[model samples]
Target: MAISFNQAFAGHDKMLEFRSERASVLANNIANADTPNYKARDISFDSMFNNEQSKLRLASDNDRHIQGNSTMGESSGLLYRNPSQPSLDGNTVDMQREQAEYAQNSMQFDTSFMFLDRKISGLKKALTGN
Candidate 1:
């Protein structure tokens, strides 16, 4: 059976999705920086990626592994709590830090999108012998 495009790029797609979600979380943190008692939220990409990889490795080791079901383990992607110095009002959201993180995440998101687009374009070319 031929692997579908989604299956082939499942890992990349999940990474992109997580990055996008993380960007949203950072943006929200920045937006709420002025709100009293607002805590900043940030995703731990290393932990998330490692967890996903472990899950995939475990799933692959199963005797009756299913193809499309491998991607179902991506639900562990979520923002982690920050342990940095908090504001006097108990707001952990630092506008400058959040803005920097948001900008970095945006760049990562765009890069991932571009990579996926290029991969898809390459696949199209291969399929069409262009």
Candidate 2:
């Protein structure tokens, strides 16, 4: 019997991709901190989840299997962050806030990596019967 790995991985794969893309966006914001009129951009996971919820599901091929809902290649929302205080040069990137966000994003990326690692390990254990 053929087992689709997609059935086992679930949404975590997508979540990890989203997190990675978000890291780049956050990094871009930090890199352009000094550029005038450069607006900081961020991704919203909640919005991405909500958008995924409306996707159409396909029928299962057999009675023993469930339909897979894994959709790949999602581009982030990339919305501009509104600055709490406007800078004299119109740059929207806040150094302190950007730093905090970068740190948080890094933590989240590590978390997602750990979760994926644990999941793969569990799958390995199951297949190996160890």
Candidate 3:
């Protein structure tokens, strides 16, 4: 029987991708902090995860059928932010908040990376019998 990696990884890979995209969105907001009328955008994890999960899941015709695998499609979960302290320039990017979020997201990405790495290593050991 072929080893199905999707079950082994258990969505860490997907979470990693989501975190990376979120980082990009947050960085973009930071980059546009000075742009007039630029609305800061962010992605909701819940909505994005649901979107990806629905796409990744496949219908099982038989009780014991191998699942389908495919590239994860992009999601449109980006939403404009409502500023706590509105700026006169109509820019919604809050420097402090954006920085905080970016840092948090980086940490989460690192965590997911570590988990996936450990899982891969464990699988390798099992296969190698060493």
Candidate 4:
């Protein structure tokens, strides 16, 4: 029987990737905060997760067939944030809001990292009989 790491790690690996991508987007927004007409972009987790969930239907030609492994889909695209107050220069990046979002995203990324770490640790222990 072949075991796929995708099945073992579940969605943690994909979640980490998504989080990293979001961090980059957020950092870019912060970097261009002063640039005129720079629109702040972000990922919507609901959109990605919903896309993943939609692919999880069970279908089998035989009763003994194994179920398909469902993995999280890649991000469709970045979503633009509507500014609370439009700047005269047309820059949409809000430093305070961007900073808060960055911090929150960092925490979520850390959480996914910790979850994957614990899963790997547990698997190692199981294999080593520790």
Candidate 5:
């Protein structure tokens, strides 16, 4: 009795998770903008998603292929600090850039959530024959 959503939904799930994490990081950067010597950190989802090792799934020898943990493990994207600008107080956070990035990430997060909601709604309708 295996019940699962379409494979397309998997991508959306991953994207939503990534975007949510990115938003948190961006928010953190913005919150610590005034903190002296505080370095801004960012994640590279493109590189993380592109990694082949992260996309790998366990293959069972028999027909019963039980899904296991992702090969990517608990590792997130690579954290990097911006090198373009440096504050006089040794802080690396650029408020303008961080605000823009945060706004963009928020929009992306909302979009992903909306898409997932719509998908679930569609499934509900289908199951209810409505």
Candidate 6:
């Protein structure tokens, strides 16, 4: 019997990719906290999930391909955060907020990594009969 890893993984792989991408975006916001007019950006997991379900899946040649929903003026799940407190230089990134978000994202990433690791370990044990 052929073992389909995709079926076994159950979309956790994609979730991991999304989480990693979000981490990069959050880190960018933190890095540019002092830049004038730099709007803080974020990725919404809920919006991403909704977009995935709402569209027909397609095989794309590149990971950089803009998601299909972007053509319709949808934000493509990348959103500019509204700053709660305005800065003197017109920069929107709040260091404390960004740090908190990055920390939360990091924790979630670790949790997902653990889940994926456990799944792979279970599969390995099943295959080895150990």
- Candidate 3, residues 32-93, lDDT tens digits: the string is 99999999999988868666775776879897898876555455778788899999999989
Q: Say which prediction, candidate 3 or candidate 4, comes out ahead on TM-score.
A: 3
Clashes of 2: 0
Let me know the TM-score candidate 3 reaches against the reference structure.
0.82
TM-score of structure candidate 2: 0.77
Would you list the clashing residue pairs of candidate 5?
none
- Tens-digit lDDT track of model 5 for 1-130: 4548766375778788888878888889989999998989998777666564566777778877777556453556657676578879989998899999989888888998889888888878877999
All candidates: TM-score: 0.72, 0.77, 0.82, 0.78, 0.74, 0.82
Per-residue lDDT of model 6, residues 90-126, tens digit only:
9999999999999998998898888889889999999
Can you list the residue pairs that collide in candidate 1? none
Give the number of colliding residue pairs in candidate 6. 0
Which runs in model 5 stand beyond 4 Å of their true positions? 6-8, 50-52, 55-75
lDDT of 1 by residue, 1-130 (tens): 6758777675678769888778778878878877888877777778677657657533356668765445543666555467477778888876777777788888888888888888888878878999
Error of 6 at 53 (Å): 2.9
Cα RMSD to native, each candidate? 5.6, 6.6, 5.8, 5.6, 5.3, 6.6
| lDDT (10s digit) by residue, model 2, range 58-88 | 6787978876675652544567898999999
Model 3 accuracy (lDDT, Cα): 0.89
The lDDT values for all models are: 0.75, 0.81, 0.89, 0.87, 0.79, 0.86
Residue 63, model 5: lDDT of: 75
State how far residue 90 of model 5 sits from its true place (Å): 1.6
Clashing pairs in 4: none
Off by over 4 Å in 2: 50-76
Q: Candidate 6: global Cα-lDDT?
A: 0.86
lDDT, ranked from best to worst = 3, 4, 6, 2, 5, 1
